[model samples]
Target chain A: MSETAKSSALRGAAKSARVHVMRSQLGRVRGLGAAHGGTHHWWAERLTGIALVPLSLWFIYAALHLSGEPRSYVVRWAGNPINAALLAALVLATFHHAQLGLQAVVDDYIHHKRTRLVVLLLIRGAAALLALIALFAVLKLAISG
Target chain B: MKDIRDALMVGRTSDGRLVHRPLSPHLQVYRPQITSVLSILHRATGIALSVGTLLLVWWLAAAATGDAAYAGVSAFMRSPIGVLLLLGWTASLWYHFCAGLRHLGWDAGFGLDLPQVHRSGRAVVIAAAVLTLLTWIVGLAVM
Candidate 1:
C-alpha cells in the first residue's frame, strides 16, 4: 500500500480501538452493559425485599389465625374485602421477589449458560403458577361470599 | 526458580478451543466464619421458602375447592408430620427474612465493617430463633 494510505489505515484502527475502550469505560460508569446491565435488577430486588417485610408478617399472622378454623370460617375470613386485597398484594410481592432471588442464585451457581437459562425460566414459571393459584383462591372466596 | 509454564496448563477441548481449569480457592481452603456460614444458610433458607410456597398454594387450592378438600388438607396440616413441617417452614421463613434485612442494611451503607458484619450475622440467627419461637407459641396458644 502507499505510505499515505497505510498511515491513514493505522490512524483509523487506533481511533476504533479508542472508541471501543471508551464505550467499555462508559459502560462501567453508567452501570449498564452487556455483562452487568443497569441497576434496575438490584433496585427491583431491594424494593420487593422491603415489600416482603410487611406482607410476610401479615401473612404469618393471618395464616396462624386461620389454622384449624372450619371451612365456613376460612371462607368468611378470606371473603372479607380487606383480607382479599392484602392476600393479593402478598402473593404478588412474594412471587415477584422469589423469582428475582431464585434467578440470582441460579445465575451465580449454575455455570452452564443453557442450563442457567432453563432454570431461571423454570423458576419464573413456578412462581407465576403459584401466584395465579393463590390469586384465584382469593378471588373465589371474595366473589362467592 | 521453577518453570511458570507448569502452573499454566491449558488444554484443547474437542471443539478445538483452549480451556484452563483454574485452581481457585473453594470452601475447604478456608476456615468457616459466621459471615460465610450465614451466606450459605441464606441461600438454603431461600430455597426452603420457595418449597414452602408450594405448600401454601396447596392449602389455598384446597380451600377454594370445597368443604371435603379443605377438610382433608386441614386434617393433614394439623397432624404430627404436618406440624413438624410447618415448624421447619416457620423457622426457615424467619431466618430468610432476617438475613434479607441484613442485606438491605449492607446496601444502605450500614454494617459494612467486618465486626459489624459478624455482629449482624449473629443477630440474624438470634432474631430468627426468637421470632420463630414466639410465632409458634402464640400460634399454638391461640389455637
Candidate 2:
C-alpha cells in the first residue's frame, strides 16, 4: 500500500475510536446504568449533604445552648415540639449520611473481602442503632416532659 | 512500616487501585495543598464523628437508664475537659458540615472551575469559623 493511503487509514481508525469513546461517555452521563452504582451513590450523598447543612447547624446551636444546663433543663428543652422534631430530623439525616460516607471509606480501604463485608455491616448497624436510640430518647423526652 | 509491609504482602486493592504496591507518584511525591489538607480533614472529621456518635449513644442510654445516670453524664459534660471535647466536636461538626456543602456544590455541577474551587474552599473555612464563634457566643449568653 502507498504511504499516503496507510496514513489516511490510520487517521480514520483514530477518528472512529474517538467517536466511540465520546458516545460511551455520553451514555454514562445519561445514567443508562453503564456507570453502575456510582451515580446513585453520588446523588444520595449530595442530597444528604444538602440536608445536613442546616440540620447540623441547628443541632450545634441547640447543643451549645444546652451547655451547662441541668439534666431537667435539657429534657425540657428537648421536649419542646419544634426542638424534638428537629432533633429527630438531625439524627436521622446525620446517621444516614454517616453510613454512606463511611461505607465509601470502607469500600475504598478495606482489602480483605470478609473483613470489608463485616466492617460495612458493623458500620451500618452502629449507625442505625444510634439513630434509633437518639430518636427514642427524643420521643421519650417529648412525651414525658 | 510493618503495616506497609503487610499491605504489600497482601497486595490489597483500595478504590480500584493496588494498595502498598510499587507505584509511581506516591502521596509524598506531591506537595501538600489546601485542597489536600481539606480533603484529609474531611476524612478525619468523618472518623471523629463516627466515634462521637458513641458519645451520643452514651448520653441517650444514660437518659434511658434513669435520673442518676443522666446526672452523672450531665455532670461529666459540664467538666472542663468534657467541655473542651464538646467544643472540639462542635467545631468539627461545623467544619464538616461546611465542607460537605462544598462537596454537594461540586457534585451538582458547580464550582468545578479552578477559581471557583478555591473560592468555595475558602468560603467553607470561613463559614465554619464564623458559625462556630457565633454558636459559642450564644452558648455563653444562654448559660
Candidate 3:
C-alpha cells in the first residue's frame, strides 16, 4: 500500500487485537529459515579479532624496525621461520576478521537483496584472494633465501 | 507518502492490510553522543583496515617478486600519497584496536555502566591518537 493509505489505516493498529500468527512466528511467511550461522559467526569474528590483537601489534613493531630498511633487510626479516609463521597467522586472522566485519556492514546497510549478495561476495572473495596472495608471498620470501 | 515508504519496512497485516514495519539505519533520529559515535567509528575503521589490506598484499607481492619489485614498492611507500594512505591506515588500525578492546571488555561483562562506557569511549580516542603518533614518530625518527 502507499504510505498515505498505510498511515490512514492506522486506527488502533498499534493495539489492534489478535492477528492469527503461527505459534512460534511473527508472520505467516516465517523468516529466511534457521540462517544456520547462529553464534558461529559471532564467535569466529571475536576469535579472529582476538588473534589479531597480538599479530597486528607485533607487525607494527616489526614494521617500525624495518621502516627505512632496504629490500634485502625486509627479505631477511621475513625469511626467519618464526616471523614467517607469525606472518602467516596474521594474514589468516586479519582477513577472516575483516570479511566478517565487512559482511556485517553489508548485511545491515544494503537492503536490496541481490545487491547485498553481490557486494558480500565481492568483499569476501577479495578478502580470500588477498589473503592467499599474502600468505604465498610470505612463503616465497621465506624460502627465497 | 508520509516521508519514507521504505520497501523493506512495508509489511502486510493479518486482514490483508498494509502497514509500516520498523527497522534501523534510523541513526539520524537520535542525538549524537560519544558512545554511539565511537561505536560507529569502530566499524568504520574496521572497514577502512579491510580495504587497506590491499596495500599490505601489494607490498608483500612486491617483496616476493624480486629486488626490483621490492624496491619499487618501497619507493611507493616512501612517496607522499603512500605515506598519507599508510598514516590513515595506521590511525584507523590503532583506533579500531582500542575500541575492540573495549568491546571485548563489554563482552566479558565488564564496564557495562554508562559512566564507564563514556569514560572508555574517551580513553579509546586518546589511546589511539597517542599510539598512532608514537608509531609514526618511531617509524620516522628512530632506527
Candidate 4:
C-alpha cells in the first residue's frame, strides 16, 4: 500500500473507533433509553402476570365453591390461612400488574406530558390504595377467623 | 386554554398562511385482525377485572361487618342482575387469564409467528368460554 494511503486509512480507523466509543458514552448519559425506567416495570408486569396464572385459577375455583353458599360459609372460607394467603397474593399481583399495564397504556396514548404524569400518578396511587384495602380485608378475616 | 389551542393549531407563517399537516392513519386505516382484536380485548378485560375487584372488597367488608350486612350483599348477589354481573366477571376473569397466557408466551419468545398468533388468539377466546361454563356448572351443581 502507498505510505500516504496507509497512514490515512489508519487515522480513519482510529477516528471511527473514537466515534463509536463516544456514541456509547452518549447513550449511557441519556439514561435508560428515553423511557428512563421501562425494564423493571416491564419485568414486574411479566412476572406478576405469570404469577397471576395459577393464583387466578385457584381464585376462580375457590370463588365458585363459595357460590350460592351462605355468608358464614364464605367468611369461613376466607378465614382459612391457606385461602387467605392465596387471596392476598392474587389481589396484590393482579393490582400491581394492572397498574403497570395501565401505566403503559397511559404513557403511550397520552401525548400530553403533563397529563400523562398526572394520570400515571393517579393510577399508581389508586392501585396501591385499593390493593391495601383488599389485603387488609383478607388479613382481618383470616386472622379473626 | 385558548392560547394553548392556538399554539397547537398546525402552524402559521409570517405571511399569514397556515401550513396543512398530513393526517395520520388510525384504527379505520388498518384492516381488523385477530391480534388487534385480542389486544384491545385484553385492555378492556383488564379494566373490567379491576372493577370486579370491588365486588371482592364489598363481600369481605360485609362479612367482616356482620351477618346482616353479609346477607344484604348476598341477597343482591342472588338477584338476577347480580347473577349477570357475576357471569360477566367470570368471563372477564378467564378471558384475561387466557390472553395473559398468550402474552406470557410471546414474552418468552414463543407463538410469535403470524399463524401461531392467530391460533393463540382463538384459543384464548375458546378457553375462556369453556372455563366459565365449567366453573358455573360445577358451582351450581354442587350448590
- Give the higher-TM-score candidate: 2 or 4: 4
The DockQ score of candidate 4 comes to 0.45
What's the true lDDT of residue B8 in model 3? 74
Which residue pairs show collisions in model 4?
none
Worst 10 residues of 1 chain B by lDDT: B1-10
Question: Which predicted model would earn the best DockQ?
Answer: 3
Off by over 4 Å in 4: A1-36, B1-24
Fill in the DockQ of model 3: 0.56
TM-score of chain B of 2: 0.80
Per-residue lDDT tens digits of candidate 4, residues B1-143? 33434445576665889975444555798998888989999999888887787788788777767789888888988899988998899999889889988888888789988988988889899999999999889877876
Interface RMSD of 4: 1.7
The alpha-carbon deviation from the true structure for residue A71 of candidate 4, after best TM-score superposition, in angstroms, is 2.5
lDDT of 2 by residue, A1-145 (tens): 9999999999999999887764465565675542235667767767777887788768766766776666778778877899989878878887888888898888777778889889989999989988998889878878885
Fraction of reference contacts reproduced per prediction? 0.63, 0.51, 0.76, 0.53
Summarize candidate 1's per-residue lDDT along A16-60 as a digit string, tens digits. 988776456556567664325536777888998999999999999
Estimate, for each residue in A48-70, the C-alpha lDDT of model 4 and write its tens digit: 98898899878878877887677
- Scored by lDDT, model 1 comes in at 0.86
Which one wins by DockQ: 2 or 4? 4
- Over B1-143, each residue of candidate 3 has an lDDT whose tens digit, in order, gives 45564767888887899988877756678999998889899999998998899889998898888889888888888899999999999999999999999999999989999999999999999999999999988888954
Query: What is the fnat value (0 to 1) for candidate 3?
Result: 0.76
